[model samples]
Target: MARNSYTIGIVLIGVAIILLLGKLGVIHFIASFFWPLVLLIPGLLFHMLFFNRTLPSGVLVPGGILTTYALMFFYCNLFGWGAMSYLWPGFILGVAIGLYELHLFDRNTHRGVWIAAMILGAISVVFFVITLLFKLGVYVIALVLVLAGAALIFRRPRSW
Candidate 1:
């Protein structure tokens, strides 16, 4: 009877706390901002399981993908969704990351997987560079022009 009462008390207390936090909007706030933990938690769990020898290397594929996507989502949530325009390459990078992890961990993985990973990684990098260049090209051109003009003006004549 005592054990039963103790368990009931604990359950009631937990319920009360949960209700209070929900009423205070804490639950809403956490759910809104930290939803990526849903993805990250499972991704990390998959990794932990594989590392602990509870699962196989194949789990790492989804683990890597989910972890990368969760991180990308968190970044967007913290900064702004507008940044997604520049970060679109991260989607391809996530797939590449997963493939690379599979290739690294799975001894039986085919060479095609590695080649695909490399191709995807290269594509992601190229897209990232192109986006960055498009965004910062004007500033780069301006800086180069200023530097060239300054160098021309400051050059010293050779002594004859």
Candidate 2:
């Protein structure tokens, strides 16, 4: 099939580049960095297959989650494992994204699906922000507390 050949050609090109890079001695230390692409390629391929009508649409959820998780792993791989502390919310967000994609593209989507996606996505965003602030250190919390106290102390009494 044309699609299969196209995928294979792209894969061959990728391998060729990696080999070239390896021969140049630039890939030895960074070979592990490419491992996540293994996940990303198949994940993206599933979505593409769905679009190309070669696979059932049900694969979208797995595809989206895999793609999101692969990116998350890639981020951690590049930034260090400590990045996972604040990036943990990506797990929930990935599922929420898949749900959103399903609800948006599926004609028979249920109202509950949208509601679930909104809830999960909002929680993930909030958690990520809070965790990131925490990782940024105690200064942010102290500043918030100081601002709140100042606001409270400066409040004027309401006229009766």
What TM-score, over all chains together, does every model reach?
Answer: 0.83, 0.68
lDDT of 1 by residue, 4-87 (tens): 999999999999999999999999999989999999998899989998999999898889989999999999999999999899
- As a TM-score, model 2 comes out at 0.68
Candidate 2 — which residues are off by over 4 angstroms? 1-30, 142-160
Q: By TM-score, who's the top model here?
A: 1
Tens digits of lDDT, candidate 2, 60-102: 7788888999999999998998889889999999989888877
Model 1 lDDT at residue 24: 100
Among residues 3 or more apart in sequence or in different chains, the pairs in candidate 1 whose N, CA or C atoms overlap within 3 Å are none
Any runs in candidate 1 off by more than 4 Å, and if so which? 1-10, 150-160
RMSD of each: 2.6, 8.0
